[model samples]
Target chain A: MELPQKYSEQELVWLLKQRNEQAYSYLYDHYSGALFSIILSIVKEEELATDVLQEVFIKIWRQISLYDTTKGRLYTWMLNVARNTSIDAIRSKGVKNSRQNQELTENVYEQAGSAEMKTDAIGLRKLVHTLKDEWKILIELSYFEGYTQDEMAKMLNIPLGTVKTRLRSGLAALSKIIKP
Target chain B: MNTQEYIESGIIETYVLGMTDAIESAELEQYCREYPDIKLAVTAFEATLEQHALLNPINPPSTIKVQLFESLKDEFVHPVFMSAPTKQSAKVFDIKPFLKYIAAASIILLVISGAMNLYLYTKLSNSSAQYQAILVEKTSLQANNQLIQAKALDLFNSMQMMTDPNMLKVSMPGMPGKEKNYATIFWDTKSKDVYILPNKLPQPTLGKQYQLWAMVDGKAVDAGMIGDCAGLCKMKNIPSATMFAVTLEKKGGSSIPTITEMYLAGKVS
Candidate 1:
């Protein structure tokens, strides 16, 4: 049977688990650049970063079955793989020259699962740009931090209901902007 | 309480964001099982969030995609190895590392190499040293043989001279401590050449060697020292003499033989 053209994140994951090359190709062509930037930023060595990038995809290929869409997006899962791999590479290469500016350097991407997102992926920055600040923050925290709304609420000092309300509205608004 | 009201209230967003307290997520899960609409709203909220992240996903360079594609292709193609039909096919294939064999082989190789080198070095040195010693021995043996041949010819020629009219022949009697030793003397009086038969003696201790003295009226005159030749025995020269005596003495022989120490005597006629 021909693979479906319109695949949800879960649907594409299922196809990848079943060893679908078309789905893998689509994911790569669409998302590799954003992942590359994350990897490059974390691992300064270009060649080593490239190796880690290759490993990230290989792991994605072999371990796609482990991804649970109920827990997070495929991009979030993939980005975590890349980030962890790069950090591991940094340790393995014994990189001691990194600046000590830990907190100051944390952009949305510095969040473990944050850069794993596709905001700039497939040019989603344009769509995400149309979103208000609250949506961006919600997206940055939830998807990036791997935070539950409870965690987000605690972190932002907002009520749980407010965190929930903001996330739902932010997502719904994103749908209209991107899909519309 | 109404499921539709709950859906409209956007409780699904809290579920997707995991912002709701544990009891709330459990309640939503219960609702999802009870009504499909609640599940639909939940998936809808999750889908938009996922899609948004997907749109902004961190894509690595093209190489990652290529590597990913290869793995995907492997799953698609599932190529089999040539020799190994199944990795689990054989007992050999199933076997873990044979470190024992590797260790044994390496050890044996190292030992054999070490021993062989040691043996070769010893053998080479032994052969070279033996060859050098043999060369030295052969050279000395050749020189000794040549000296003996020349002495034999001299003894023969000197005997012929003794029969000549101008030469005198004398026999020396072994006397006193030299009772076992006797010698013949050929004195070429005209030429003042004296050849003694068997000019040989054993080694002496410190300050001692045999001295040959020419006797004139029983007083000794110096001839030369003797009995310490390191080379082979041969006939040797002496001066023409009225009489001959040998005595043991201090090294280089005293200016004259100490008469009390005379070991042998001969009268030349």
Candidate 2:
């Protein structure tokens, strides 16, 4: 059967629940790039992020039935799936290494090359770069790195309330900075 | 509750970021549905995050999509078999063994009557047949009672949803050419659940089904397909809408609504 090119969020959710193959392809084609970038930010390797993207899609396909629209938008839900899956991959990689290697794994970003990476949206990258260091760190750690608020507070040597406040303002600022 | 303070407190941002724990998330979502300001704040953050992702999309190798679809091919093989059974049928005790016992008893009676007399044998067999018929009737009545109970429970739930103060009832009258068709949507404001009751709407022709649309900000959002639901067919949950409509589409529904085939339309007040 011929499939429509674009689907509204609700229709996409419905068809995905039905396990429609066309819808699945539509979902991948439409959202994979965005999802890949999120995974790349967390995992920081195109090859690894590609693998994680596959896992994310598989998880989404298997668990589409459990998705509750009331919880959030479909992309938000999928983003969580992608983020969590990417985070899990990182944590497991750390666990697999020796204590020294684990520390090295954490610092891998400093040594990793950015030449091969292609984050096509130069404006978005520029906007994020323009944010204050603290705000950028807060967004990256929480959003990309999937760190919890309490963990961030301890790590940042700030009170839990401070972390909440900073995160709020940071996100609000980020939202405004990137607004088209 | 001061919605402005709550919004400014940053919980909505955290909630949109998927950082809020279950309880906090649930509370924020409740507030979102109840307070327009909170909802708008949540929506704004969600939109911002979506835009953020869209702006920084990194195309994965094209082969990944091909591999992904290949991995998912098994799911396509038996979608129907793997689907969860929708109807929970009431289990009735099997009556076949009872019929066998009755048949055996009649044969025994026949053997005994042949030795005693034929007249007594006919009377015994006739009474056994009557008893068997009564047994069948009783079981059928029990099954009918269970079915009625199930139906009653469904009616009760439908009524509760319909009578809920948070539920908005939108009566969609037929469009110009199909004026006789009508459907009512019972939408729960808090839960965002949508149920469409096709009252006078005609049955869709083969290979076609009626699809529900929630018009939000002048765009048609797919609510769900109206399949062969009897009393109150539950559609997808609609977060927000200004109007609702129904259009005939190919079976399984279309991604974009076929506006020309719209049969019913109604504004939400």
Report the number of the highest-DockQ candidate.
Answer: 2
lDDT of 1 by residue, B1-269 (tens): 58777776646654554445689878888888889888777666555655555555554555555655665564675433323222223122232436999778877876897798789878977987787788677777877876885565455445446556766767766677767766566666666766555443334578887677777665677766665232222233555457887777888778867778766788877
Residues A1-180 of candidate 1 have per-residue lDDT tens digits of: 133445566657765765767777777766677676666655655788688878887888788878877655676567678766766776555334234545455542344334434434334434544678787777655543345677777767789778777877776565556442
Error of 2 at B105 (Å): 30
Clashing pairs in 2: none
Residue A8 of model 2, lDDT score: 80
- For each candidate, what's the DockQ? 0.14, 0.29
Task: Give the top-scoring candidate (lDDT).
Answer: 2
Docking class of 2: acceptable
Query: Per-residue lDDT tens digits of candidate 2, residues B206-242?
Result: 9999999999998999999887654789999899999
* Candidate 1 stretches greater than 4 Å from native: A1-56, A67-99, A102-136, A145-155, B13-26, B44-60, B69-269
Model 1 chain B scores worst on lDDT over the 10 consecutive residues at B84-93
Q: Write the per-residue lDDT of candidate 2 for residues A1-180, one digit (tens) a residue.
A: 124567788878876876778888888888898888878777776788889999999999999999998767888889889889988987777566546566445544432223212344233344655778777666666766567878778676789877778877776776676666
